[model samples]
Target: MSPSLKAATAVGVLLLATACGSSNGSGSDASGLNPPDLKAQEKLGKTEGEVNLIAWAGYVEDGANNPDVDWVSDFEKETGCQVNTKTAASSDEMVSLMKTGQYDAVSASGDASLRLIASGDAAPVNTDLTPNYADVFEGLKNKDWNTVNDVAYGVPHGRGANLLMYNTEKVKPAPTSWSAVFDKGSEYKGKVTAYDSPIYIADAALYLMATQPDLGIKNPYALDRKQFDASVALLKEQNANIGEYWSDYLKEISAFKSGDSVVGTTWQVIVNAAKAEKAPVEAVLPEEGATGWSDTWMLSAKAEHPNCAYKWMDWIISPEVNAQVAEYFGEAPSNARSCELTADKDHCATYHASDEAYWKNVHYWTTPISQCIDGRTDTQCVPYAEWVQAWTGIKG
Candidate 1:
């Protein structure tokens, strides 16, 4: 089966499971591109040491030791540092692990990075120590999650948008509005799917900001009382159309394959898997734009293997390694130079790695704190706390 078909089948299975219960767990406009220089930074130290890393389940894979894979052996062979990895299913799990000071690095998504930084469990990264830091796309450097007060904290890895993927056969003309999932009228009753996690509650808020002007929502992740109520009200309507909420990649794919769902919110990874599985799934970038998350490689503050951690970070972003990481992770690589190394030029085009036009409008995800959007401070919106409460109420 093609990866797409496999993904659709997986999503179908996930939908079935969700029918049983609730699941847990960029911008751009290159005008903002002022990436830091790494050439003047200190050179990397010695290798041949060990480093423990915590990351999402599928991130570090080697195709051996578990059939699914483990990526550390290759690093061990090259740097002589035995890589120890602990897989986590959610951001919460990653935070608790970091507090123990047992690991050296973490592959954290936007949702978890702030908690790591706020707790002082993760340290500000010394970009100088990682020679390959210069290769990161200028647009991704020093954002709200990884940098504070201009000091660097992590290396850009790869990124992708959360797309609306659907079966073209069932949904005609393709969906352009976020309302396709949010609206619960007769048109989409019991056919829509939503992301099952609490974090996705922000998506409903984003839709409200674009469609409803009176709420004056500056940031979807940051919500004031009225905006919060408005978003929760919208989600209550959305829940009526939603057939089920999904959490697993394969499960999401399965939903599309079986035609159990005609349309839903999804990731490029899930879409890629579905296409590889031969499912007739198409991913759409909506007209009003979309929200997305970017994951970064952050080093733990109390890392036991700091030198080895730096070495791995440097190696991961090198053109060759960046290409491999992007392809394996099924997303666009953040290294501008890696475009030349990609095996399929069309893949780069499809993924928007080389499209400056697309990046100009895409709003990269950030944790909603009092600061508001990464660069916008003209007005203060609500904080993540309000959004979290609204989300909880909506779920209830």
Candidate 2:
């Protein structure tokens, strides 16, 4: 992959989010949180001869980065739609790119999907129009971050967990829990790392969910000020031993390869990238479970080539392409059938793509809103804005 393009990935997409709210004037209503009422594509039209896209780096590959990784060329050939892509560096950049309406579609993660929907930048998807949608796993459908009032906004592309990756030689006994990066992070002091985003507060919250039950954090995303403060406090303490925070997966890979980062949050692709270069590294889903992302391919509200966009969505998620992208990108394919097509027969198994038991503990990213998503009506949870504010303070 090209060095610049390689910087973009689902993980760099920050696996991020917005505050989801239930109506009480500030949140949701009887129907659900209100999204800008926009019409979804009801029927297919003739291809416009081209489509433009905003996607994470590893997606929308057309062999420009690596010959073996081409997926977009065949799509253009079969659908007669030339593909133009823009690689976004962060979840915020994606949301900003989508707002321009110059692109027809984007591969959006939970963190950015809600903002797109709420802003009317992303249109609702008629999944029926995409035949391949039927093969997608049920778990990734109509999720809180991607849906509103049960309305499906996009199609699932792929998913993965933020794991505890460590240098096998430096860390002994194979730590099984997040404590390695939290409670015991001081052991590595200058070598410890964490994701460089506010959502990381949830990692601290997830650890507290298991070890500090007194904090009363039922769901990581749904935290009141007290629970939120506690999580931030833990992060502040952790910051003392922090080596650096990473938003780019490549940087994280480089850190691990150099022994500069011995333990911290990472994605499977980073582990694979480091391993390919002969780095002695391995990732584990610690006993406390973990946080994750299931990104979606959402159509633009004012898409200039709606038909081509629809065709592209269906083509990308088709089994063989999905498998190729998943293997090359290092995440689980959303299509259940794609597992059969991966070059490495163990790809899905290695990533736990179909292991429900393994995923049950994995909390997918969501925007923390004023109304608590965890069913707590008595108190308001800290919204995403506060999360941003606290994150700035934590880093300061």
Candidate 3:
């Protein structure tokens, strides 16, 4: 199975098991709750000798998977901070793990970053402490996903879109819009797949933003009760057409190769892998735009190895290292300098790493809250916890 697939399955199982749980944990509470009062580091300190991290499967490679692919070793050797990593499969799991205070830092996606900030699990980053942060794409820095109240919470890592992948041999006429797997999804019933997680609700909401503009969904993540319900209704309708909801890349690859799944959502890495295996597949960012992720490397509020954690953040985003990881993980490097270091001359162009215009319509995942992230003050928006429950019901 692919790393992304593993992440999806892990997320799917966890979301199902914790579906009934309250979103009120930490950041999901009623409006007016403030993030924990934690200050960013003011100065660099002595190395703490070690750092523990919770990251997505492919983010922290130390050569265990492949001898040729190892970035953690150099980080450990350079900083003298022994690197111990825990792979988190889902955003909720990252949030849950951070709450324990056992780890020093995490590579949080937009969906989990806010919850960590609101719950006080993550600390505001002192960008000054990590000089490499200055080289990150201006488009990624201090955005709504990693910054709150004008404070930076983490260092931007990388980003990618959830593209529309279809079997060229099976899906005809070529799809340019998300409707291929949405309201018109029934046209390819029993052969469609989708990412299996509550975060996927935002994809439905994104579609509604274009197809049903009256819903007034200025932000897919900030859906009000009505908009949220409509998004959920769309998912429920889509469930019948889904041959399998995938979080595992291997399964989706197999499904497409075996002719069980012809069209649905996917990552660029998954498409690359499938095509390399001789699967007749192609992926594109549809006309309605798409949902994507920009991961942040956040320091834990209660981190034991602050100096070492800060060191890792800087090293990971450095041009050479960032290029290596971004290429390995198949996402655009957040650092602009990394583009020149990539082995594939076209890597940046292929992923639109520096294309600011291309990302204008791609909504990054963010935790939904009652206060409304989209700037509406008239109504309370649905929180992520409710999204979890609704996702469970829709799948049922």
Candidate 4:
């Protein structure tokens, strides 16, 4: 599908999902699992002396990479909340860490947000307490991944799509469809790469949604047994031609630079890094659409530093800070105002931060559930736990 056509179709889906209240439900009245009885903080109070966080590596920078990249220090100084961060490499790890109840906040991706919400590991955010919440993009607010039953669970962080990256010199005609890495993967046999996670199953599910309409696969994350099996089957087939599945940026960049990977799924940041190394590569959002992520800065349900956590959430999404984080993280800023504050004037444009149409075909990752996120009551859908096992099986 052309970008415009995909966007138009996405707009329709978005409208339907919004009107229905929960993406898991069809328009009739499907709802998410009831949130546990956890109370949201009613008011902001005195800042605690310390705040510990669980986050993605780039989400919470203390200037360890470069002297000019410090946002945590300034936040700490302003609020007197000494910052301590523990980086989590995957959503499952974040979930496990949050369950320990040792952290104050987490930058939860879409896949883990619902699990946290459903398990009561995360508390509903009082947007009124976070002043910067107003500046976040309207399109990001109240989505299925961040909000439950019309209640906000976290502050919207940055977002980006998983793109198709190909070795420009080796792949002729510049492939525009996901099939180059799926259905036609044999063409690049033993040279194709993919994400190294169970969540990646959604990528195949997304492709199946576009290629095999007979499956009735509505949402990539919301797959029943039949659809889920079909997606897994496709992955098993692709696995035959896989060179290496990647979970880290540097690893994939190295693989591409060495010509071990010729084509596969990738992130914009990975593409930028590869090109910087002078590797002949290009990335695109294929016609079949793609799975993406929208992260949320969520407060722990048992937070001991509620006041400081609230302060951090508001500060992180503020114009200047958001711009810095978005640019460093290579994603579209959640705050619309952050675009103007970005050092590179073209940062927002390059990531399509403000382009709602472009995001239409980009399906943000959401946790799958038995209630059927796509609104099918006739069959139970596979959950994330099952996906983990399936991933192990496929990789084994």
**Per-residue C-alpha lDDT of model 1 across residues 161-266, encoded as one tens digit per residue:** 7778878887777777776777633476787888876557667767776788887765566555577667778887777777877776676777788887878888
**In angstroms, how far off is 154's CA in candidate 3?**
0.3
Task: Give the TM-score (vs. native) of candidate 4.
Answer: 0.91
Q: Between candidates 2 and 3, which one is better according to lDDT?
A: 3
Residue-wise C-alpha lDDT for candidate 4, range 1-396, written one tens digit per residue: 322122222222111000011232122122446888777899988898999898876667787755667799999989999988987767778889999999999988877888889999999899999998998888788887887777889999888888999999888889999999987899999999998878888888888988999999888888888999999999999999999987656678788999999999888867876777788999998887777878889999988888888999998999999998888777899999999998779878889999887777777877777788665677888887798889998887
TM-score leaderboard ranking: 3, 4, 2, 1
Candidate 4 Cα misplacement greater than 4 A, ranges:
1-30
Question: For model 3, what is the error of residue 191's alpha carbon versus the real structure, in angstroms, after optimal superposition?
Answer: 0.4
Query: TM-score of predicted model 3?
Result: 0.92
Q: Model 3 segments beyond 4 Å from truth?
A: 1-33
For candidate 4, the 10 contiguous residues with the lowest summed lDDT are: 12-21
Poorest 10 consecutive residues by lDDT, candidate 1: 16-25
- Model 1: residue 26 alpha-carbon error in angstroms: 8.0
The true-versus-predicted C-alpha distance at residue 283 of model 1, in Å, is 1.8
Q: Which stretches of candidate 2 lie above 4 Å from their native place?
A: 1-32
Best by lDDT: 3
Q: Is candidate 1 or candidate 2 better by TM-score?
A: 2
Worst 10 residues of 3 by lDDT: 16-25
